[model samples]
Target: METAFADYLDEFTRRDWETLDPEAVADPVRVAVVGLGWFAREWALPGIARSAYTEATVVTDVDPDAVETVAAERDVTGVTPEEFRSGAAADAYDAAYVATPNAAHLDYVRAAAAQGKAVLCEKPLEATLDRARRLVAACRDADVRLMVGYRMQTDPAVRRLRDLLRAGVAGDVVHVHATMSQTMLGELGGDTDQWRLDPELSGGCALMDLGVYPLNTTRFVLDEDPVRVSGRTRTRHEAFADVDEHASFRLAFPDGVDALCTVSQNAQHASRLEVTGTEARLISDPAFYEREDRGFAVVRDGTRVDVDFDQVHQIEEEFAYFGHQLLADEPFHPDGEHALADMRALDGIYRSAETGRSVTLDEDAA
Candidate 1:
């Protein structure tokens, strides 16, 4: 009998890369996480440390106290931003997780690539497509593997949906509707200096923060690039004056399939995806970033087929997958090309929102 990890490895190999034994690698990958914020401290650091093929060696942040506290809590060493800038601090780790703000992703990624270390960057890749392309090229030139932190790709429920879609269990996908919204983030406005509300850091509000989930998930599940896009966006809160607080978009695939997605910072709660097909419809509950009891239902002929998944920490799954890839010498999932495509889609969304016209990807762009 094969374990879930073995099945995951096999699936990744069958879909994306060649096979390799995850157990054969000699050294545990030493990793440093470059942010001591909520995400790094609460999720990523612990997950990586718990992974079998990786060890959390160091943490860095501009706030010394924050870094020190996370390090003390996680039992890892700490490095100041000044030490990181001097290039003396990052040498101890074989790789780095750039969990910084959206705009800073490229710079941190480039720094790690320059040091010939693999990098796992938090999403949005960069605030712009040009920067993302450059980062991808730099990583390739430096022979460093780069992966985006699109943890949904490693999620078991999402994986199951992908399988169903690919296997034609949801036959001939015609339309997809995805919604992601939350009031929690907007209410917890702490520092006006926090990067998320700043256009220079968070990129473009709800779209960059939450829209990326549906956009990425739609592309992943359908295995198709959007051919054209049109969008409408608004900034509802004064705190996000520099960025949008709500956004909705329509995407058309080459095969006539359409996707309608909405993201908002002021909504009451979260919603998920509804995938409609010729034969059946599939519905996912609170689809994005679900950590516990995450599951889906398949509806065919007005009957519901229920599916249940064990409650697993998505961050843990993500770290474990990354570890397995590194140890097995397997190709990184959500590699540079995937990141580039996602950026292209996002660029289209922004353009469409501003121009109030449909934006189409050039053949070369895809």
Candidate 2:
């Protein structure tokens, strides 16, 4: 058996990925995609389409026309939400990818788990902390693997950053600063029915959507949970009156390690994660994109070492890891517990922002 990290050995500068061979597992996983929306249609499907370790067996959506459109292009069976919940569909796939909205993740995940299919869900796990915990419990009780769709966990550059931190190359982590910003309506060109503005559907605003990148990245790099959080959220424009347009939060982890993160729906353009330690600093600009290539840098004692990574399709990496977990019974890196921890911290952040006070967290609660 090959080591799990063998493929990533030359990921930093590898440009010949087209010639790279596919994985040799016992059986490729058959995945039923539960949503046919923008993210599922664009980013996720392309990766799943490429991976030899996974196949999109069926597509599910409330809108049959949308499902049929995606099905025709992807060459997968299209099913309505009702048929997807039936027993016949349950037995068709080894795993289900929950690409639905943040708020609806719980029901879909629970249903998939109950049918004894492994689940890979998009970030946040659920819209809120309570549901997140329940989803985790449901999966656990069903004895099925539950993984969060966190591409950064498998991203080459991000993995290099984590490796450096773990190897103490940065020397005693002290602080981290991250930012992810985008003009949602501008980029999406969608109307208000986008479901992101509704508190009941999307949960929170920028923090719940784009903020997860920084939130999950900081935690992944540090490998530590936050003990306290303080945040502030605002509705910068009348268009965002029902939800927050901007949010900034501070996290206090054990050993005095602190992190600052900002997420915004009204910003020009910003995506970065910077880690500063006693000895050096590591930075990743455009930290959370699905592009095929990106660059990062390491700075120490006035010397800079820039590293450029090629073939950065994190979604493929995510699917590969999920397939490994299914075939080898390997642990999912950012497992359900990993997501629940982040949801708990986000819950604290939202409460702190609303009350204008620091929210302390108990390690035992999560």
Candidate 3:
């Protein structure tokens, strides 16, 4: 297992982060990762391992077999869910990473925050807006930092796009079209025990599972909130009888910027983000995912300019930023308020989809 982890470490090169002083990275923030699922194992673990300012000291999960498997590969203490909720476990770490199922997020977060530990929660905040608000308040009352894991918000390509828009390379941004889809049914066929398929566990369906990407990414890039939303959804397969298989929605921002976004569980794998303005347009062919290499292009005045970035890891930057917030007293980006805003927008979207009418959102809902 150690040999395998060493090989995994070799697959990626070390990154130089501008946010922290390489020589000054000491007393790494100890983190307890609650949930040993696919995302936690595949992405979050590797990302946290590469950081100089953070250490994953403890891991928790309900399945003892899964916990044993992960514990063998990593040098971290593995505890069952019951032990993790106890007071002794809370005192063992400075922060907790909540990567449990969607429905379990709030409970894990509150447990960690109750221990006076900072929390890095996986996206969506909660299954519903009302619950999400309560979760945020709990963390605030505990006086702990709460950051949502919107990995792409720290992506180089996404940040470059934002910079171009700020530089007026796209003039006044007018429209955005974003799409993200994956064949979940084909990928995990007949896996009824999969928590994501259960509406109670996953909150909604495709929108809650996949739609949050385009929805949150657009808002991140634009740095603006929408005033209204209209949405429609459908469940195309019996396997997804309890949840949506596809969803489409449009958001109207205050400054006349309109965003059309779609998510699906029954489509060819695709992820793209395009923004149009009066002067030019910017496009990210394979946008919003953590990858070694991705391209961003700009089309202006009948000429195209392309920029290709070297190997970059979104998860690495995410944990590094969390470390920055913990160690350097830096304000956390995409904080709880950010997730709450997205939740509010999604709440309006689901309502609009159910009633077949546009839903208006209050700008000052916090």
lDDT of 3 by residue, 1-366 (tens): 224322322423333234568469868899899898877898899989887778888888988988888877887888888788775677668999999888898998988888899999998888888889889999999998999999887776777677667666677898999998888766556465688878888888789888888888888888888889999999868878888889999999987889999989888888899999998888987886564356677787898867544657678878887887789787777899889988988888888999999998985554
Candidate 1 C-alpha error for residue 360, in Å: 0.5
TM-score of each: 0.90, 0.93, 0.92
1-366: candidate 1 lDDT, tens digit per residue:
123323432443232322444466457788889987887876887788666667888889888899888889878778886666466766688888888888777777888888888888888888778888888888999999988889888876677777777777777999999998877364444455677778877777789888889998888888888888889899867777898889999989978999999999778778698899997787878788543356578788888867644556778777777777876778776888887887888888888889999888763563
User: How many angstroms is residue 51 displaced in model 3 relative to the true structure, after the best TM-score fit?
Assistant: 1.5
The regions of model 1 sitting more than 4 angstroms off are 1-26, 184-193, 290-292, 363-366
The TM-score obtained by model 1 is 0.90
The whole-model lDDT of each prediction reads 0.79, 0.82, 0.82
Work out how many backbone clashes candidate 2 has: 0
TM-score attained by model 3: 0.92
In candidate 2, which residue pairs clash?
none
C-alpha positional error of residue 189 in candidate 3 after TM-score superposition, expressed in Å: 6.4
| Candidate 3 residue pairs that clash | none
